[model samples]
Target: MHSYFGFLCLVSYFLKSLPQVLCQRTHANVLTNETDAFINRVLADWNSPGGIAVAVVRKDDQGAWNVETKGYGAATANGDKVTENTLFGIGSNSKLFTILATGLLINNATLSPRLEWTSKMASILPTWGLWDTTAAKEATIIDVMSHRTGLPGHDFSYKWSDDVPRLIEKMKYQRPSAEFRDVFQYSNNMYSVLSYLPTVLLPSKIPFTRYVKQTIFDRLNMTSTTYSFSVARSTGLLADGMARQGINFSDNPFGGIPRALPFWATAGNEDGNLVSGGAGIISNAVDLAIWLQTLLSNGLRPGTNESVIPAEVTEKVSAGVSVQAGAAQFPELSPLVYGGGAQRGTYRGHEILERGGSIPGFNTQVARLPFDNLGVAVLTNDNDYGSFIIQVIKGRLLDEALGLDKIDWHSRFKALALTTPPRATPRPTNASLPWTDFITLTGTYDNPGYGKFELCLIAPKHPGASRSCAALASNAPTILPGAVEADIPTFLAEWDNPGFSHIRLTHFNGNVFNLSTLSSFPANDSSKPYWTHGGDSSFSSGAYAEAAAEGRHVGIGFTGIWGAGAGVPGPIGSTVRERAEVWFHKIPYDMDFHLE
Candidate 1:
């Protein structure tokens, strides 16, 4: 009877410890096979023209990590293959590195404790002269990093310019989208300021790029990572950026399939020929794996007990600093929080930290599961469809690691993508409406929130062709295109950002028209918000009239979408519910409009 009871106890103990024993036997080979198969499946599902590179690092029971990289598609138009060493633009993933640099500065005691993370911008940059004295006085380093400054993205204002100082100066004109420290609004302009702040505060007068390299990159041994466009171009390992062909068409929500853009050989050129602290860091799967390992280990270099970033600093930066607004796409990940350029959320009851980046030609995502000591970084040249692939792969990997049921992320994403409706076809304009109507619409328009811009009527280069309008000039100079019109009677609307300068208006009725941009995608359904290729501007109404007496001849109301990424669904329903409406009023051509 005693022996039988002991045998029963032993059986129960073995069953209780079965999962742990199986997990211990999950070798590097098993992980590698699973990850490779998962990535291959994702590549096949996405069918992107350009290459994608992914690196997954998992910590073993002994505290060391097993790293693996899987590369798919061509790295360059010239047919160079992607490898672990192939460098691709990491986009906003640069933000995490920037935050680490700031943390390192604080850890080193180079910055005063009070000013390290919470000092007011006005106190630190008193001489720079911000237009909004109130924001300048109250916005802190922590506020900016955590995206709680109540500022809107204002992405259009400095999309093409490399002048950081001028961009900072222009922030004065941008109004807050929310109350101070009350809501979350992602702002790259704010991050640009954060990256440059250390340079201003540090006594050595070091440039942001140099300071980051000397402090963080050098310490982590990220030898191939670079902040300079010229250096990235010089390296043969740099991957060529690719965008889908026919991206301007509204019918093609998937960006019309990726094609290599050899002109975008270097990633840093998008920031106006300079290294952008916000979205400018070029690295590869191998180097990024090292970065992930460092992050997972709480800023400690693996194998060598050397601490690159202080553990306390890492803990503070990773902790929630601001509550993210609304529910995320995955309900399990609700109540998101932002801290030091990374977002923290719960995934199936496990802690997950992530950040993603989208530039003109590249898309990237980096995620870490600190509790599991696992990390993944995905870089792709195809901007439009890359996010979908990354999210799918990340989700699958996490599910496998956590011993959760495998979800069909590919099928789910495909269903969502298929549900997205193509842009609405514009109705034919009333040819009978006199040309005088268009003539009256030609003038300069001004918005206090934006700036002065001219709309001029341009005669078609060919006879018997439609007359189009040209955006001649703007208070913001880099966006000027010198009065060139489209082949049709297209009117180009100028947003604060230059990339959003291509909206076309087709007349639908008297003094009313249907508005669309080269990048506009139709709503997935009436329940979902319309997707724009640029992910910024959305036209609410395009109308004009001959109101010569009031100086308000033409008016356009547009709602700007703030934080939607490539392939990500924006807030659903009416634009009014999700974004702020910006109004532009046309003034006489001779009138000198001024912004308040």
Candidate 2:
């Protein structure tokens, strides 16, 4: 009787301990189906076009690694499904690779001591002329990487141009947004310039793309990744790009009746021939997992004795150099700091390193919790919902890894999206101002940072369209699809060189004017510019011109959002509330003036 009783007690004890042991193992190696379901549910709920792919890698209790991959929706509207190998633009995530490549060159002792991060740009690229020599000379490589150069994002400078060298040459004209090392302004142009450094310095004369591939991608066996869109397409791995048909929520299929957008319309459109250090890499979830694993493993290849990136270099590159304000929408993640190419922050008591990238039709996010030995990479093709979807997935994954109760990220994000205010309607135009009101506005405007532009009054084609001195003009013929028609009263705003030249403007109110292209304005708002075409297109709410310097000058502010498509929210300050403005001084058409 005693022996039987002891056996029963032992069984009870073992039964109680079994769950604890299993739970520990599960925390390390196991990913619950509920987590997968949640990811799928979020993507489905968003009705993400071209689908989404996610890769997760975590370490088991015994130090062994496990990888989980999930793909939801189709890669194309024709029903081709997303897979682990489907290629998607990684966007600015490419910046991290560029920074890593720089670190590698430094590690290899390829750069001279004088060319270190603290070295002046003028010293490094001496022949590269700069308008503000003093400020340019004071700017350092570290300043560029950490975005403390006081140079605002002159994103429009290269938004549609493939000529990187010309872009670099134009940098001389751009003014700093703030004092040296005083503020953080993300600048893709800086990174694009930085990408050329390795080619200039390397004895072998290899391009930046080749250098990255050899040192990083090749070493890590990330074969599916490349900086070239053509290369990705050649491999038949690139996913089709997609966009929403109309801006209104009523146009959303999931919201009410299913309204199909012109999916796959932009499937094979080429972004450009040039490589961008800031936002050009194309990759897949499978390869990105390897990337995260290598990073988390302290620059060593997983399950191998080979060292890829030096641990010291990784630490140096990721060390916080500049502080960033916490995201208001994501209050849980606070104290964000910008490092070399990554962001360091704390989420729910766990330290994390994260980076996000967005291009025309793709959005990507890679996040790591080093202490937990967990990492996640998400790639999606839908620009509108991509950012929100990625965040929800990351949050859910973190909850699972940390054994915390799951948060309803999907519902919260959905609510936020639905609650976003609709675009404002333009007020009715009942009054027309006399041509004398804008008499002083037509002149050559020069900003040392942005160069020269001219605003000219166009002669009216129709008798009723204008008076003798009226500044009325007509829109240009359709250069892009869905552009404004030529009959609208317009003003020709031309840039000195190519790119963003030939903007047609129509008067809206007192000093405000609307931009029009070749096509008729949508019935919703003819006063606002809409970018229906894929890729980088400029849009504006309106341009407001005000007299300054007691009529000596006119300050024109181009207020609107700029990005890939119409009706999509871009980076903060991209809306009409903030604008990129330039001042025009009345000068002789034939007279030449040097910008101070």
Candidate 3:
């Protein structure tokens, strides 16, 4: 069976390499009944009600391209069905634009240093420094763009309100989880810093927004795709984002629970109000069709023989620069490698460059098969951890295109995705743990890298996370999912952080708390959370159980001088990204500090 499948893959590659014969099936044939059924069945099986826009572009005979675009499910509550042009935020897929925009500068370099992949960041920004002194001085444009920089994503540390320059200044303070180029650590902060490079590297000193607009957007004629939601909304074609009920944390299906989520907006403006360098772009299949073809042609403008994305730029962005996974995740694929903004690996013997991204309510995936001259993009207006459903869908699409044997991609991934691990045994709490234990530590604690937050004594009606969200925090019990009314002198970590209403901290032991420990409730409601907090996206709208289909949790511990001073070794941030636990010593006022 394995040899037969391999023979089919080889034949598919050979046939694709041959010049397209007009007698061959049209591109429309790519979306056969089999493909459609596969997509629908997986979506139904996973109980995903929100819609998705899928576009497939393939090189035909004579080097021309053929396309098939379609939409499935409702994009809005008014029952407006999703179509080829409905705009949905592509999330971190915007990183591709950042890399292509960098390619533009590289192609048109007139600077003294002549910025190339190897140009050291230190020369570009004197402020660019990191705890890894060697990496701080030696890291290059490619290092940051490829996420080979020592820093992990210290996502929560970013001030959504700060301008690019200030954000660049804050980069130095973010601790690094590994030495330079030791391992691949995905960092939005690293990508976020690249957004500012246009302003610094070129004589025009253009912000990323304006520079990419002049260079890439106009070149591709993507008028509908913009960093601004206002522009997308003006078309009256923006998709209303959705999430599964109780999915913010529960893995089980809630009857395909679909709830409308707000488009990412702030102070009555687009999500671009936050940051565009990392994750921020609203586009549809129409514009993305052009993008996929461009990638398929290695940056050419489809059949015109014109280069919209300089060929050199295209090559560098898609070429793998660092190892993401040291071992193959499956027998069919090669070890994963992150190119510039996306990932590259083989799938069932076909080479593929791909990436998956999501914000609070929207999830997206894009792929390029340079070897076969095929490309695909899927924009899903529903929340998912890694956009896995689309991942499964795309795999089957490839198999259908190649005429290979069907594999149960959905069931295999579903089992892996939905399998709930046994809950950890709870650490015994101090039997006499008193309210005084909470009150004593109820002050601002600070980290040089992560900054500061006030851990409050009350349930946020007093000493709120911020006065701005106080009313919301006070009413949080009614709004937040899995509402935890902690019985053992629980406290709330209140901060007026954008994208977050409040976080509930429950007592675990003497001085530690489980950030994510929760009590189950009937979370399958249509109404979205009044607020959100997440992995790397501080996108200030919609709901993200960001813990995802499973009740994912965060943990925090306060023990004998437990941070920098206490000699806790390693970086602080999500355990997924950090080398050690995040810690912050209590405020200076808490001298000799066991204030009970």
TM-scores for the candidates: 0.77, 0.77, 0.82
Error of 1 at 271 (Å): 12
- Winner on lDDT (1 vs 3): 3
lDDT by residue (323-380, candidate 2, tens digit) is: 6554534656677778788889888888999899887667889999998899988888
Q: Ten residues in a row with the worst lDDT in model 2? A: 257-266
Error of 3 at 318 (Å): 1.8
Model 3: runs farther than 4 Å from truth?
Answer: 1-28, 247-252, 265-274, 421-424, 427-436, 459-473, 494-500, 517-580, 588-596
Encode model 1's per-residue lDDT on 172-264: one tens digit a residue.
766565667767778887778767766677888777777877877888889889876677778888887666544433455554634554323
Say what the RMSD of model 2 is: 8.0
lDDT of each: 0.63, 0.64, 0.66
**Candidate order by decreasing TM-score:** 3, 1, 2
lDDT of 2 at 28: 45
lDDT rank order = 3, 2, 1
Candidate 2: pairs in clash: 173-449, 174-449, 175-449, 473-490, 483-518, 483-519, 484-517, 484-518, 484-519, 485-519
lDDT of 3 by residue, 1-596 (tens): 54664565567677876433423433445687867777777766766667778888887655667888888776885668888888888888999998888878778757777877888889888788887889988999889887777676666565555666677776676666567887677777777788887888778776687788777777888778888777777889998876544443343533445556666543214324445888877889888889989888778775576888878788888888888877787788888888788999988898999888787668888888888778888888756532777778777777766657878877778877775544544446444343233445555666666666666544423453445345544655655533545454445564433334344555545443545312212233456433332211111211111110111222233221111211123434443224233445555632432323
